[model samples]
Target: MKKFWLLIVFVSILFSCSDNNTSNKNPYIPSYSVNLSIDMNLPAYSNLKFVSNGIIIPNYGAKGVIIFNAGSGYTAFDAACPNQALTSCTAMTINGINAVCSCDKTEYSLFTGLGGKEYPLKQYRVEVIGTVIHVYN
Candidate 1:
């Protein structure tokens, strides 16, 4: 009886496993480790204190990263356009609450990071502790 239960559990575990790489792969942007800390008290990062505002910090990700204030919390995303390969014009620029790709003119919302056709912006994890905002992969 114990052997039968073990076999059933093994089969269930095998069936429940999924090939996550095949489904969630984004072939455009190269992966980079992002460990950034932004102080809201600083003059350069003070703009992030308000909702619907975003700031682009260079020398971080594939094409730097854009940190946005989404009212409820903060969010960060790779500035590279996810629709195509990294090119001269692939770096996105902040326009209000959206990040616009100069290459294909694709507009990605900073609020939800949704834009383009299939893949959305590669978002990093954001955590706000007091006045310090921690952004990481």
Candidate 2:
């Protein structure tokens, strides 16, 4: 019957339109074969306040960010916004003790490595063995 075909068509369309929600896929984190060390007393370290290479590093295990301080220390974190993961703009800019992402202007505290405005920046583990900094996934 025409009504039966119409019903089937409507059901098919509804199922097709249903959100194909996929699980959050982990990002990739590059490996460093050589160990690197930076001196905090160096002029280059003291001169530059912030650095941006316009590159995004995936965490592999989860969404995160990594900040390397040649002079002082190294930091890593999850790039996903703590408040909400709906937006793709979770990357943040470091401003002293805070990291602010241009998208939504979400501010995260670098000191505590937590998100502000009811969200916190998920932090990763960092090991400083002398001048060498190790960031692991």
Candidate 3:
């Protein structure tokens, strides 16, 4: 009876194990301090108040931070292209809800942050509640 209980506990622990997002944690994307919040209802952020749209908020992240309203919620990404060394041209431009890297002409999906590129844009944490959109690294 004791052996049976021990086996059950071991099995439970094994099934409860979880994996981390190591793939998304890229080493190439330089880490910089970031902590910004914007009210989506505000006139300045009105462009981002709608779904399937993105905006670049200056003075944040390595290049800049691009935030998008992807229908579900908001997502933040580093504007620097993850494919190569960071440069001026590597800075991404907002095209609808996609981020285009002029350096290699690669585009990353603003919604999922993964498309038309080997490496996805470095993403940051985003929290939306009420009318506030918080982005942090």
The top-ranked prediction according to TM-score is 1
Candidate 1 wrongly placed segments (more than 4 Å): 1-24
The number of clashing residue pairs in model 2 is 10
Provide the TM-score for each candidate, comma-separated: 0.80, 0.46, 0.78
Error of 3 at 120 (Å): 0.7
lDDT of 1 at 9: 49
lDDT of each: 0.77, 0.44, 0.74
lDDT of candidate model 1 versus the reference: 0.77
- TM for candidate 3 is 0.78
Q: By summed lDDT, which 10 consecutive residues of candidate 1 come out lowest?
A: 15-24
Shift in Å, residue 115, candidate 1 = 1.2
Report the error of model 2 at residue 43, Å. Answer: 10
Clashing residue pairs for model 1: none
TM-score sort, best first = 1, 3, 2
- Best-fitting candidate, scored by lDDT: 1
> Candidate 1 vs candidate 2: which has greater lDDT?
1
